[model samples]
Target: MITGLRYLNHSDALFTGKVPHQLGSLTNLQYLDLSWHYNRPPYRNVDNIDWLSNLSSLQYLDMSGINLTKVDIFNAITKLSSLSVLHLSNCNLKSIPVVLPYVNLTYLSTIDISENDVSSMIPNWLLGMHNLVSYNGISTDISKLIRDLSGCARYSLQRLKFHNNLLHGKLPDGLAMFSNLTELHAYNNFLSGCIPESIGSLSSSLMYLYLANNRLEDPIPEAVGELSELVVLDLSFNPLGGLISNSHFAKMTKLEAIFLSSSSVTVNMSSDWTPHFQLKNIRMGSCVLGPEFPTWLKAQRNKCLMQAFQLLYLTGFGTYLLKLST
Candidate 1:
């Protein structure tokens, strides 16, 4: 009898029938992962997870892709005071409990409830997770979620993934509050309006910013250049206008990939102005690049994706004449 066992990983098993409740006897278990895939599963189902409360010492749990429709999730895991990381993605969860009577896991930091149908507001208890750093809840009221997160996880939260959620409306202006935030992905949504100017405030840490395939309009804010650590910037498929000046890339020294394809913005930089970053992939199709192709591109000798720059005006359909030095 391994009563002292502290870690168990039974992920991706084709186990059928009900989830074994006897696992609760492992009171000292600090890590458990019974997650499986939705397509390859014989499908393990858990009608109730009341026994999870017994694993008071549990620090990490990942039950993603399990059938947990009948579980009282909020109440079952609330008492796990030592639990820190939880993943419940694609669990067939219908709703997130709007209110939790009490929250005991003060040290909990990372949680993923993505790909669920819990189309509700960000729960109050979730916003109160004082130490929460990484949250991946599925789309909800975008405005409300940002507002609440700005106040609660302002200093702690870092990565936010709300992409492909059909989220609408403008990104609220208070984003600067997440001082520690590094990656922000809200692409493939229905978000409109200009990127907020306050985004410059994350200059110290912000790295990857993806807002592609949205209806966002207006000029790309110069504040975006303030993200000194930024690597990938994708704003493709939007109807953005105005001159894309050299100031936009003045401080993006670490930038590698940039996608501006199908956008309406004109590259109005001085012909002699060289970019600060060495871009590897550049997609500027259908954008106004030049009467004479910008000579600065010659500086990116290591760029490998020059074919992606099928500047329609300069090179007629499929004519990739200028190649990087490699």
Candidate 2:
């Protein structure tokens, strides 16, 4: 089984009694997916580590739905230095292993340790990744967590997800260092403070930004409006006041960008901050616009006729404000 054997997916298959300790003999395996790719439960070998040591060539490990909460699993798994991807979603974990150190994962890419009990400060070991991507599925202290991952700037990751947790505190300045980030998902947390202004320097490659369901206050920085190619931006269910005055989406035109599929959008604010551009169908709710909605959306020009109208509206508003000052 060590010569030509490749993958072993026993998700739905029954291994009976205990997790087979003999299957770990495959030393040349590269990708080992045990997550029921199409919804399959793995071999019922819940938490047996006797044979996993034989997987020296194992790079990608998917042990989801295994009910493996050994806590010491990573201590043994870290022996596989070639590991790149590790998915442990929905595992019955109460917290991340702090006593263990994952020094061997130098080339690791993504990590999904979600649906567990990691309800505290993220381990500093996570910052060791030089090429880490996604760090989703955490359900504990977050303010300090973001601060810890700030040290992992050498990798320039693209995705960071930490939603549905009781995370409180201000967003960190470390995010500015993630210039290469493409998506950041931190919804359903207890976060507060204004959205950082440094986000203006983020890479244009960013396609998704989910910051809904938090206590983030203040205005949505105008810098966000600069993301000319931004597609999905959700910041719903937050108590962000003074942010309604400016629609941070003022510069997206799509430049002949065509959409061939349906899309989903989430908003957590109390206002409709749409830029005066096009008429793409949108679902806006829970917005704090109260009963009187903003006029920027209705004034946007589909062609060019309404362009003058929008400008005229802005000009009139400015003039009225100037008159009040005089």
Tens-place lDDT per residue, model 2, 1-326, is: 35557776665455444555666777778887766332343334356775666787888888776667653677777787888888887766667766564467787788888877665556656667767877765746565566666677434678888887777777776676767788888877888887787776774656777787777776667787676666766665666544334446656544222121111222223254555446433333423332222455444334321111222333254543344355
> For residues 227-303, what per-residue lDDT tens digits would candidate 1 score against the true structure?
89999889998888887888888788899988887888887887778888887888877777766556666567673
* Model 2 weakest lDDT span, ten residues long: 255-264
TM-score of each: 0.90, 0.72
* lDDT values, one for every candidate: 0.84, 0.62
Question: Each candidate: RMSD to true structure?
Answer: 2.8, 9.3
The clash count for each model shown is 0, 12
Model 2 regions lying over 4 Å from their true place: 1-3, 10-18, 36-45, 137-139, 241-247, 253-281, 286-326
Please give the RMSD of candidate 1 to the true structure.
Answer: 2.8
